[model samples]
Target: MKPLVILLAAAAAFGADPPAREKLPTSRADLENGEKLYQANCGLCHGTKGDGGRGAVLAGRKLSRAADDAALVKVIEEGVRGTEMPGAWQLSARESRQVAAFVRSLSRVSSKPVPGDPSRGAELYARNHCSACHTIRGLGGSAGPDLSDTGLRRNPAFLRTSLTDPEAELPRSYQLVSIRSNSGSTITGARLSEDSFSIQVGDSSGKVHSFWKHEISELKKERGKSAMPSYKQLSSADLDDLVAYLSSLKEAS
Candidate 1:
């Protein structure tokens, strides 16, 4: 009886099942580290934070909720080929986890509305030259896709990556074309309209070209690639603000 009493006392002192083993952070620390890593490695083009610069802004957009941590890890490891997002095999498993955390944080923060600044976003959109390529509500150029109802088609996470790495996940239709002419000039554009005889392409300058497909000596098409620039130079906060603005561009009411 004395021994039994001592055993129970010792168990109680150990503090009830050892405090549940301190549940591991769902990559929270990794997320913080990822933010730092992004600044160091991906900031130049993707922006310091995640705002558009030479690249796309990636804070508020939702890409694919179906992609879990493992899927994201694979992408980080393998990298998206045929795009500016070079393979990041340099990162270890832990480091990749950290980046995923940072990416997830973008949406959580940008989910709220910007107080007293509904119009600020519209102004920013124009000032940033987003309209130069992307079309919104029948405005802007035809060089990029129409973002008239982007809020409905894309999620915040997806939008963030799209900004940070435009070529990362490209739409099926917007394939990249690299045409080498007889004069040794190379023309790269997004395939706007194509056929066996003639093809229409939209270049980065917002100019469209109609070329005879048969006349093209060497024509290469990189599927699942985009001609859009990467916005890896903006700050994380700016990226968040930009994403917030874009996400709010929903159809009227």
Candidate 2:
């Protein structure tokens, strides 16, 4: 099918009139309920108006254009593992749909980058020591996945989350590690740097530790979350600037 037809079909499925470009909710009550749900559950991280804070900004995001209601509902219910956002399966299906509606409402306006400043982002990357764990351009640590082509693979929303709450979104290969010592001590963290003889782990505290394979008597590997932390201290402008920087690092066409 043509891309235009697919878009129209998606719009129609969401009760949106293509020519009007207006989303028709089942009822006003649903919209209101969605707003309230967003406030109570998503406000702190995403901000009251979804401008982002401890969480990635949702306002003016283009996610709705890429994802439909069903996808949105899944994200809300399952939550993005390896980040600060937790699963919200407790919400009823109706409520989940309502929240999805609210999130979609935030995307009414598009938020494209104004030609990102890769140089500025490069400085930010170094200052933040992102290279300590993640690799970029074949230079950096091996703890996280190579980000050389992240611009193509991930959207801006996902990139923002990568900065703020990495653990919320878990990648496929990076498994979570739970280590129980012979003394009955336990530790849980994501693998940062690992090899055949030794493994390095980063805990929730942002502290990284290395251990030889023989040292861990009871090592359990589970689905690991992203080891990134929330940037609660960063101003909104700074967050946007950093996002701009990271989003610009796309592979050459």
Candidate 3:
């Protein structure tokens, strides 16, 4: 049968509300409704066509978090935990289903080619000693966020922007702090955690230091400042290669 017929069959199967276990089917009405909903609700970050802006690129790639139609629906309603994607709190299950179907269809759209070679990017990552601060595949340091599955989490645009402008969109958890002791000495590092009585910090050398509030004269939490240096000086090709490498760090198939 033709693709159009297949789509219509799926749409008829959906009716009004279908079980999560069922596959997607789009009647003409359903397709138009889904597209309208998606454009209105998801166009800001995901783009009207799901080409992506700040969110993950949804076209022409195997979605690691959403493996099937049911999975996509679940993600739409519940959201991906620990990431910027939020749950469809304003949308009901049926509306969420509509959005999920639209998003899934975006996979058939053509995606822009990823700019550089992954192999070259991998070599660049090691040469630049990126593992000194960032952890990947459980083998690197932890001063920064673990990037073992960065490809699954962030898009290339975000990655490239972060490289050239480290101060932009620092992780919400990022808290580089300066703590001054009663003795007038100071220590600066990433804040691991803080409680009413004490706080933990990871210093530049990756040594975690614990201190009591009583001993600290002042504690200042810095924002919009990343310990990561900007890579603006890198050549365009080098930058592209680096971004490609970072984008390729997906979860195991």
TM-score of each: 0.51, 0.50, 0.80
lDDT, residue 89, candidate 3? 87
Q: Candidate 3's error at 129, in angstroms?
A: 2.2
Ranking by lDDT: 3, 2, 1
List runs of model 2 lying over 4 Å from the truth: 1-26, 64-66, 81-84, 110-117, 123-132, 137-139, 143-210, 213-244, 247-253
Per-residue alpha-carbon lDDT of model 1 for 1-253, expressed as tens digits?
9999999999888766543321213655666788887777666655565543434444665535214556655666676565456657788767766776676566455543433233566776677788777888777877777877565445566677888988777766677898876667788988888887988888887788778866678889977677887777866666776766776666531
Q: Rank order by TM-score, top first?
A: 3, 1, 2
**CA RMSD of each candidate after superposition:** 12.9, 10.9, 9.1
Error of 1 at 112 (Å): 6.9
Worst 10 residues of 3 by lDDT: 16-25
Write down the TM-score for model 1.
0.51
Residue pairs with backbone overlap in model 3: 10-25, 10-26, 11-25, 11-26, 11-27
Enumerate clash totals for all models, in the order shown.
36, 12, 5
Off by over 4 Å in 3: 1-20, 23-25, 47-54
The lowest-lDDT stretch of 10 consecutive residues in candidate 2 is 16-25
Tell how far residue 168 is off in model 3, in angstroms: 1.8
| lDDT of candidate 1 at residue 223, scale 0 to 100 | 74
Cα error, residue 82 of model 2, in Å, equals: 5.0
Better candidate number, 2 or 3, judged by lDDT: 3
